[model samples]
Target chain A: MSLRLVRIDDRLIHGQVVAGWLRALGARRIVIVDDATARDEFLRDVLTLAAPSDVPVEVLNIADGAIRCIELAASPEPVFVLARSPRTVLGLRQAGVPIEVVDLGGMGSGPGRKRLHKTISISPDELAELRELERLGTRVEIQIVADDRPIPFRSLDSTH
Target chain B: MGFGQAALIALGYYLANSPWLFGLAYYTLFRPLVAGLLVGLILGHPAEGTLIGAAINVPYLGFISAGGSYPSDVAFAGWVGTTIALAGGLNPAAAIAVAIPLGLLGTLVFYGRMSVSAVFAHWADDRAEKADINGVAFMNVVPGQILLFVISFVPVFLLALNGPGFVKDAIDRLPLWFSDGLVIAGGILPAIGIALTMRFIFRGSAIPYFFIGFILFTFSGGSMSLVVIAAIGVALAYLHLTFTGGLAPKSTEAAAEIATAPVLMTSDETAPAGRHLTRGDVLRSWITWSFFSHANYNYERLQGTGFAHAMTPIIRKLYTTPDEIRAALKRHLVFFNTEPNFGNVIHGAVIALEEQRANGAPIDDDAINSVKSGLMGPISGIGDTLSQSTIAPILLALGIGIAGGTATGSSIPNFAPGSTGNVLGPIIYVALVSVIIVGIGYVAWMQGYLRGRAFVTDLLRSGTIDRVLTGAGVLGNLVLGALAAKVVTLYLAPTVSIYGAQLNIQASVLDPIFPGVLALGLVLITFWLLRRVSPLWILAGMLTFSIIAAFPFFGPGPQNPNDYSYQACTSSLLHKYAPCGVPPAPSAAPQASPSPAASTAP
Candidate 1:
């Protein structure tokens, strides 16, 4: 019936989200929106196996995911939406998925990426996408677990 | 106390934090319980050291390090905290207060090590490019371990050398109320660890079982031990499983349906049977992974360099030419991180692909890399939940219970001095964890190698893992509830004046309704607060609350007038505020005997 959370984590469906967030948010289902994962059959199977038997997981590309999110909003079940990158979340929002707030769970360090918070790294491109999402009226917050204090994206030192 | 002992403990700490000995150090020696026993042995006061260590370990029972985020450094708390407590002759409660700040400071050391070791990962990448296999392996262990040793040893050594005298002086200068507050804060701090773990494992349908464990222990009037409670819990879990369709034939039918469902086939299905890797090759690779998986753990590539090091044996066995070897090494040198034990399946499947590729299969670089990346996240999800949240915590609860003397019988007021628990506690814990890690790691690795990619689907379709997790949930909640009752200490120091007679709120009001009701309430409130606030804030609040509550009228005092002595009161913070009429002779022997009766004071 409602989307409980929309999150961005590089390591999707890992311990924190499954054990910590799902129960904390009371979401019964998971819908991972990512183009690469949606196209990869092996990844899909692994993810499905990774989830608890009771909670169903749906992997969809951005275009299909946007449509699915609208339908999920109409349903009675609570859903938790996950994506790997800010770009994916931006695409979903632009495609008309009514996202008001975005929770950044994790983004590991890699090439061309600068540290944004604890264990969260963002590239210039991803930073621009997050900025664009914020401009569209979505509040962005960085929180690793449900219990941790959520740090506003805007509050972080962005001069670097 | 001496230079030799200090240096020896520092060396022990270095080895415990190092990646050698198949990573067993992190599981065993790194625990404060064991660290206490080890430090105790070195200091010739093994029992006293262990008691202090066990007390400090109580707050870290829920410790979990996932995705390279460590909430607190237990190793620092265990090694350095235990040493200081022993040398300063501080009791367990005050020692916990000291240990906590050190644990927070130790996080700086952890982050520093993680960030700086990234340079070694970059160094390994260069060696892989040059086909320098030895160089790559060297970079993984040599430089990273040197950094770890320096960071781990020097600080611990310095702290052990000078920390005790400094802490003793500080405590000597503290006002009576403030010292009492530190003890009160120590009693309340364990609630945060329990609450944090509750966030992860406590959920709908399993919530009631926690209260069941708590009530069972509390109402038993200290007659029930943890082992007895655990037995009842296991039986209850079995019954719950049977009635909840966990053992029903319909679930098996559903599992069968999933097994027969149409599933996509990967490259393993069309294997062109070229060169096959021997069992020895896979075993060697797994051993390498088990021992050195986090040897070069860093921010840039988390476990990338370690992954390449693990694959060297397989790559060597499969590839002969320099170009082939270089390509194979470089293929696995990309970003990868997962739960090392349960994530061994990825390693096994990749080994199969590499073996097939060497024999002339059509598998490309993308196929192998995709398998690693795709499976890492999902495997880590299940693995971290099972290993970190479920297995480790359950085992730790038992170990802590035993070491703190709460498991044998509930008569002990959790970690009371002069009641140093049996040393067998740490030994049993180490043995059990070693068996599980080695056994599970070997089986998961071999299963993945033998069944290839299909193993994951088969493992999930069997329905056994679900049952195990379900059973673990019930058991984990029960033990945690029992642990909360046994470990969390919250005694109300305030008294209410009713009808011209003073009434102790803790005894007359709370205990008559339910024993440890305040402790239970504190844990639940903390659990609720964890949802909206960080643990650090909760800790700060508890400390401030305790300190402010330690005013002359509000603070706790000795329960019995006879049990109080000025020397005993001054030495042990528990009885410091007891109203002794007159100071005893200076030579009055200290009453170091057990004061279990003090908890029931009027």
Candidate 2:
């Protein structure tokens, strides 16, 4: 029933995460959920190697991941499930995946996104997804980098 | 990769897909597999087509770069080489030898496509300001891809399907003069590329060190490897920093800037700016704190260290003031760029310097400029070592592995597990990308927000970053050494078994220091001939040398220059797959010559 921290990073297994994040979290597994990821065999193999071998990684798609939420409830291993978009989380919740919280990570700022923090930003669609996650009982937060604290997404929702 | 094949592919692709766009000879689209398959299916060897196609893709693994620069034209080469290898009754090596010109034809294709791609970029440009993001993105990605496919698909198909045994007949009848001319010309063309590389990185503080690394490693004689040269590199990098690094006053400017910025991060901040991580910050962005992933982030507008400044929100929320952010930014500032490798902070640090100024960080104008000033030397060093010294050689090594030892494919002495080898293939990319992305990411985040004046001052206290580079250099040297022995220049060609004719090739202008020191003589000759010589001259020299060597007047070996061909010598397994505009390749392996490269451990 525990997911260490929910992050949305495209490059799931990289040096910064392995050397910096893993060191900070004292985590055991990195769970990735992305529909596109499932289709890229080479990417999957490469990502698996990027992360720490000692700390296992399970790259799953949103549907399969949500269905396997029961596995999370069954197993005690601390995990971090990374999704590409907030909607994926909403889909997970609707699919019966029980998640307690979600933290925002690096999202490359582009159209539809209003800058929330220097490293943090979001779009209207994303804001709605956050609201959807919160409605599903998952606390939504606005955190982009590792050296920061939790700020409720709702606090800045109106201005942004 | 002969000239005819490239022309055929370009013509075919354009005609087949878009008559408006000549896909002929464009490297990205030059699909040798399609060509080979088309040829084999027609020439009684679908298996051969598939075999050649698979083989041609090898050198391509490491083929990508920031720019579209590539060395092979697998499309034509694949079609023709496979066809020739099959119908000409030649082995793969000979087929490859015959295909070199075809691959070379793609070079012209590149020049042509660059001009066309510029139009597409301009087209994308018009859409970008209009806020047509997807349109712009598509323009950037799709046009080039479509163009490539067209150019590759048609020409390869036509040449393979229609081109005849002319090349084979040429092999038999093309007089020694023409044949010898090709061999000579082919050997010299690379000088143009080398000169381009050298011109960019030949100067600055790190130049002498490059020489030291080059000479010492080359001098050591045993399988000169990166491990060896990198040892000297470690010493060179460390000494350069220790003796000359801290002297710059930019640190003070950086300190002032750090003192100005604030680390007022939001709660969800999880960027990796290495300022002291607060417990709350750790708890909040725990997922990233333990790094379990990666991202290919491009702050298109945030050039330089603006990326580092992007972490401003996180830093501000995590810390009370700019001190922590400053510290983090200072640690990240360096003359880093990913052309050589990623994870380099030089660009990020410079961006931070810019942001500090923009945010009124009070860095002395002169002090602020130091970051930029400090970059040229380091950048130059990295460019030369990574791109010219290491990378070029590795390309050649991969070329050797894929092309195999025999000039003739059938005569290949060894395929020597390249990509599948622990180092030559995918691992090279993984190692390179991991190093690059994390390095760049950290620098970007730091420059974004973590830096302040005090923070900048303390971070560069001469002990921390210096120690890191020195230690890393040492480790790099060790690792590069093992790689040199095992991965880079480890191949040994079968020595010439000559009769009792006194060839006199080994003249000791300065008496042979070691027994049969002809290898040393050869190295000196190549160096002298190459030293400050223009590439054209170098080409001329090589042609002259190859011609002299190929003269039946001189020897019985296949003397025709056109005799050497290749399908995709560059597409060997020794390269990494592309993650960005370029594929991931660690520093290149030095060129394999009878003379050692500078891979002798320091």
Candidate 3:
């Protein structure tokens, strides 16, 4: 895909995306892959309204997201891919979508999750999936925003 | 008057740039509603200033600056609009008309300033490479603020000092019919603002809430205060959520439980943590974020430069080696953007992480970045809804109501322009906003610092935010409805004399049907237009309609200062419950007075 960056952020699009990352990356469009949000008409509308007027947004389920990514692989404009969890990205990779680098942006704190970065709180199950993706040769790195140098996921301690 | 107004304009300059010193909440002091009141105080007409500011603020209710792109400048419109209106003796409506154009023009300066600030950001980037900490800090605040000061101060200063005279002289020269028509236009124009806010607050199911407010005010004879209505709205919303159960999603309850599951220092519990940074350092960084978070906002790395600047004190305190210092600066200089006040928790969590990393914690730079990246969006969503959409509009509406009381059918005139009511509106608004926000913000920052990322996540995921938003929406609807009933005045004075019975059309026919019925209809019509047509079109159409409608032939003329002609014309339109308050002795010289202003209350 012509995806310049693939980020895992629960909040698929927000101030950091519109005001920070989009400008820093200079991406033309954002493709948010979250099944629940894609089906929710209300949420989809809210996301579009929240987005900056210039940049277009596409909300799609995993299957559609994979197809769109494949189509965008040859498109002229670079696309920024985002999902709420690592498993979603892993699914795309398993489905024959080429994702070399996955930027870990934000995974919110909750039960059964250990705090990794100030922004990332991950469950053991999710961590195993990410590790599996790393073993499969995806350069999964923890880079919250564009300015920071991406730290290799291998460097982080997987143990809770 | 000239010197005082010039000084107030200088204050406006300081208020606009004061984010670096006073914190971002101080930015509200520059908003038109509040600024107008301050200008009024300076010009010996605080009430008039507040009334004018509130009116001017209506058109800009939905104004937002997403990603440093602005549609208009509220500070310029509010300060200059209030000053010109009060000084020139124009009503609130005419002042809004004048202020809107000025606000649109102010956008040029905003864009110009954003472009110039990029130059300053580049200079900071150079200093970052050299590890010149002090130089980087200066690049962030000094040059950028100077540009902001000049742009904000000069136009407002010149306009406030000189524009009044021109406005007064121009109005004096205009034909009486045209000036009277302006007053009519001013009265009708507030509908546009009321309608605009409706568009923002209205959604599925929420639509009925608006009409409930309208019906309540109409049936109650429009005497209730906004606070009382708000209380009623809150109770009703709570009951609706409790009984209906379907309106608010059920997941919110489960989310709330998970959110408040208690503070877990999961990974940090095992890490060897010691006090490396002092309380003073943490507070310093917090203050810095408060002031300079958006100071160097640009197209690239939105708050990147400002974030680096905020971290300087902490970085200097922690790192001794040049490499460490340079790395820390570059690390912070990454992309950062969030809602300023509520978003301070992220800064707090970062400060705690920095302290641990400095004290031999295995935490690498990526951990810190992830924490910020993760928390920024969720925190920002809560912050934007709470601060911008809910708090601002609710408070502004209450302030406007206090200033502009419900006096449509009263014998006494609608609260005079510079009266006590008008002055109190802005003062109360400033007080409430500062106390509630500043108090909550301070506690949250400290909590985030001590508790780290877990605290903010818990806070964001808590269902309290959703419930609060729902309640606020209900309150906003009720208040908007109350405001329509109180402020958006429209009536027809056409009377029919059948068989010499001399029937009053509005009082006899319309009052029996509903009070504020025409105003409510006008607001709904404007709301429909606002949805389909551009605001500029609605504005132009209203101006044309009001002026044409104000012609003497269209209805009864106002109480003419020179003759008894208006009294004779309107005598048939007088209501049975009240005597026409026209003075028995008609004076020789003309004075300005409109008999029962049909389209506008003030």
Candidate No. with top TM-score: 1
Which tens-of-lDDT digit does each residue in B235-262 have in candidate 1?
Answer: 9889878888783221322344445654
In TM-score terms, candidate 1 sits at 0.89
Q: Fnat of the models, one by one? A: 0.54, 0.00, 0.12
Docking class of 2: incorrect
Each candidate's DockQ:
0.50, 0.01, 0.08
Candidate 2, chain B, TM-score (2 decimals): 0.46
- lDDT score, residue A96, model 1? 77
Strongest candidate by DockQ: 1
Q: Positional deviation of B32 in candidate 2, in angstroms?
A: 12
Residue-wise C-alpha lDDT for candidate 2, range A62-110, written one tens digit per residue:
8788766557745776566777678777787788777777877544344
Candidates ranked, most accurate by DockQ first: 1, 3, 2
Candidate achieving higher lDDT, 2 or 3? 3
Candidate 2 lDDT, B1-602, residue by residue in tens: 34564455345433322222211122212344344444544544454443444344322322322212234544556555656555554333234335655666755544455445544544544543343434444554466556655555555555654444566455556554444333333323332332232322233443444334333433443334443454455566566666765333212223444445454332224323424444444223222321211111112211112222223333444334444445433332211122222222333344444444434456554454444333322232222333333343333322322222212111111111111111222223324433443453454334323442223224333234334433443333333222222211111111222575322222222113332132223323433453445333554465455444443342133322222222011111111112123322322211221111101111
Per-residue lDDT, model 2, residue B126, is 54
Clashes of each: 3, 121, 5
Residue B8 C-alpha lDDT in model 3: 73
Q: Ranking by TM-score, best first? A: 1, 3, 2
lDDT of 1 by residue, A15-63 (tens): 7788878877778799999999998766777687688777888999999
Model 1 interface DockQ: 0.50
